[model samples]
Target: MTGSLISPRVDYASDPARSRGRFQIEPESRTRTPFQRDRDRIIHASAFRRLKMKTQVFVAHEGDHFRTRLTHSLEVAQIARSVARTLGLDEDLAEALALAHDLGHPPFGHAGEDQLDECMEAFGGFDHNAQTLRVVTRLEQRYPTFDGLNLTFETLEGLIKHNGPVLKNGKRMQDLPQAFLDFEHLEQLDLDTYAGPEAQVAALSDDIAYNNHDIDDGLSAGLFTIEDIKDVPLVGRIFHQVQKDYPLLDRQRVISEAVRRLIGVWIEDLTAETSRRAKRLNPKSVEDVRNLNEPLVAFSEKLDAEQKELRRFLMERMYRHYKVNRKRSQAKRILKELFGLFLSEPDTLPPPWNETAQQMTKDARARVVCDYIAGMTDNYAIDEHRRLFNLDAMI
Candidate 1:
């Protein structure tokens, strides 16, 4: 079976021009590919800069190391790069996709998202994943003639793969590609199928990163306890899974240490399983291809199921806690006041806003209203609320 299962190495999509650039930092006496260029471009974009102003689970200013979207993206990039390298896949593509994945998230974290969706319900409810793709491809206008980033097909496909790929013309990344809807296009299947190992690794790595960090953030917010987490049936299963495998179940360091061990366990299982299959079939020839012997990416299904249950636990016990509800209610009142006062009495709005609002179309005004409210940081939101309502004096 050495060569029997192998197909010829045919890349219909890896062309340099496919990524829309002629090399901004041309080879320092070398050649850089388009995907590599894409990665670098993202490393410097302003939208990426705004990530510092955005929230992950907690407010961005809470602590230096507490995760921001920027921090989360960096972590995801590191994890994705590690997995992609180990799997013999293109690391640049994985890195670029991971870095750009959350670029569309609005301010004030997901609360801002909930508000945006509620406000835009008539405009086809908001989805961060789709919005992410839009940011790089269209909405993120960094320059004239640059309403979109015009990223490579691979990067775009991965961004939209959160739910599934869209198709247009005959390509997976074309504007809602028609080929994607045909169901016969194997390569166009939603990420659940046919994604190369990098794509799969990137997906699971995101889950791993967010799950662990959300728990960390929840604790920081004084929202949950190790004891509380340990009591859940599924959470208990995870804790036990870690203790049975890891030697240093140090009580003071348990959760963070456990997260690392769990990551290693999944990586080991995935690597061993794929390597066994490759050797069993004597896949020498295919393994010679750039990324062939690289293990197919996967997480333990058991672990993934455990994570889902754990997240539900957080949602019920921490995220929906009354204190959190109070904060969100305060947030809503602030947003509603800002929206109503700014729009209803544009005369009283900040100077630039009045002009901006006057020029905004009805749909555009609604979107601007969402953006205006979403852009307010926690303290800014509160202060603006007081100032607008005359509950407090302005600066």
Candidate 2:
């Protein structure tokens, strides 16, 4: 265990003398650690389950193959794990982080989020990542005094980084080198911020998954054609990589093939570079990841470029297409009506939610309205829309 500090499972962040708020259900005596408990808590949470009903591109229930929030998260977890395990890092923590990554995304996908963001602009304003951090840290309550998953600083750090540097308390996080210093215990952490390497990989993995899957979903929904998608150069590169890395995977298997190939390339690049770097370090200790010379930087830059290009391709060809845009607009109407009905109108709201809304503050009521829409499954959101807002709602 002497040289084991270099291992990924090892908590690189200096230990916190105290991390308050324990897990609601501690894992039984086993190989699972606290982070695993954090992961499992997320896996089993009611919030996590709601992902099945949320949209990823084309809405759920429209077809079996269109991506759902759950599937997208699973893809991210799979990618993160492959990267973590290849380097002997902590796979469980990465898996957990991926699952919890999108817990704060509202119903109707980004459109619903856009409406909320605009409406709540006077408030903190909504960003999925910020909301995700809020969920695990405070809002996903199934308890009284303590809400959220109550995960460790390590896990929370992963969520924050995966979400990318945030704007919190009127500050953009990436600008501040002392991000971690804002936490409860400042001294224990070495880095001013502590987003594990796996967290960074997950952020990029999210981009990789959605870029391919969104194209597939759009085509399946008849919004675009594979030929239309192939016209984009980045799309061509993706499929090219897909065929080269995964000959057996068909064109339709874009997400899986792209993710698998990306992770493999990164791991191979990372392993070779780390090994080379190890040879150059002094006997006293290895060079920290920060000290890496140009090779690592070059690889990272290349990956970033590809990811951006791929995302842009998806945005142009599919995400912003007329067919998808029409549906997104309708879905926003559905959620907006629900927001006004359940939180603003008050009378037509469901009994339970109506009661909850009544007890909330004005701003809290609006957020509660957002949370209600966020928690709804795809089918259920439609059902609620009919029950509360539609003329045919009444029997």
Best by lDDT: 2
* TM-score, every prediction: 0.72, 0.76
Misplaced by over 4 Å in model 1 are: 1-31, 61-65, 166-197, 231-252, 269-297, 342-356, 371-387, 390-395
Q: List the residue pairs that clash in candidate 1.
A: 87-294, 167-176, 167-177, 168-177, 168-178
Query: lDDT per residue, candidate 2, 108-176, as tens digits?
Result: 788878876766665446667657766675657775667777777667766765643343345644443
Question: In angstroms, how far off is 393's CA in candidate 1?
Answer: 4.5
Q: Write the per-residue lDDT of candidate 1 for residues 295-339, one digit (tens) a residue.
A: 344544665566678779988977788876766666656666676
TM-score of 2: 0.76
Shift of residue 28 alpha carbon in model 1, Å: 13
lDDT of each: 0.60, 0.62
Clashes per candidate (backbone, < 3 Å): 5, 1
Task: Tally clashes: model 1.
Answer: 5
